[model samples]
Target chain A: SQQGEEDPQALSIQEGENATMNCSYKTSINNLQWYRQNSGRGLVHLILIRSNEREKHSGRLRVTLDTSKKSSSLLITASRAADTASYFCATERGGGTSYGKLTFGQGTILTVHP
Target chain B: EPEVTQTPSHQVTQMGQEVILRCVPISNHLYFYWYRQILGQKVEFLVSFYNNEISEKSEIFDDQFSVERPDGSNFTLKIRSTKLEDSAMYFCASSGGFEKLFFGSGTQLSVL
Candidate 1:
């Protein structure tokens, strides 16, 4: 079964605008994390919000997690053309030798037009 | 500024052939992982290795697949007999006992 499912499938925005992506997952989780992948590039870690934490931020990225609903959201403020990429949500299952293993979502393709 | 590094940005092999995708994880990290993504598909986990043994693996990690940490620095994933369905971008990632992972650029494998 797929653990993470992202909403909207795709998002588009203009420079200086804000883009938001939502993710829902099944199974109990230890933490939820966000990653970005540029065309033909590797996944880059963005931010991590623990199950206990409600919200966290880094630079222009803000992440919020609601464990009760098993959902998370990533908001990129003041978006730029450089922010065009695929955004994925990943989860670390709560039980049994996780070793930081992550299950990734299909991802939301975000295009920022300048 | 450390990062996971993978070799052979692209690999093309015939079906039933053996293939080895290599990775060099960060020196201080203790865990390594292999994930793959088919064109237009979600990234899927294959296996995770720690302390020279596999800590966890997915159903996709069948008998034909294997992972190794031959030395202190290099981690590798080997497919004994490749299948046409195995064509995908294989990614190598590592973590220093944390949830935030560092991933390599990936090896695009094509099995024909």
Candidate 2:
């Protein structure tokens, strides 16, 4: 029972194409963050978008959040083979004094072909 | 960039045995957390520690599991008695701020 469920559980794309993955959450959130996990590696922090913000950009990645719909999308532009990894969306549960205990989604497995 | 580090890339133990997973969070980070991911499942929060005390814990973090920062630089998670269900990848993380967190490579626990 994950709070955030990512759509398109698996995505495969060729190099240089844009990949878009969407995530939907059940409860309110203080913020939503994206992470990338290479096989047998740690989760790398990608980006964090606060509840008040609608969209954010970093490097070739762009994230859009729609609070009303309780959904978010991560867009990776010009995806490279190196970008192939599992992408997860984590939401810091709102209305708490907790110091960022994030609830992560099942993650979308992205496969980029060179 | 400073990153969180974990020891014993993999640990195998018999059911009912005790195991302690070790982690060294970024030196300056004050907030630390433990999370686990079962095979094919999402990452689940287990506990959060700050100011030398446990700030929050999840239902999954039962009486069998505990966390401590015995020293200034290291954080540890102790499972008094591990079960087969406890087999999972345990991740240690730290954050200087609540917005972004750095995670360790994770210790893969296999309970037999």
Measured by DockQ, the strongest candidate is 1
Q: In model 1, what is the error at residue B67, expressed in angstroms?
A: 0.8
Q: Model 1 interface RMSD, in angstroms?
A: 0.8
Global Cα lDDT for candidate 1: 0.94
Residue pairs with colliding backbones in model 1 are: none
TM-score of chain B of each: 0.98, 0.98
lDDT of 1 by residue, B4-110 (tens): 99999999999999999999999999989999999999999899888888999999999999999998899999999999999999999999986789999999999
Model 2 segments more than 4 A misplaced: none
User: Model 1 off-target regions past 4 Å?
Assistant: none
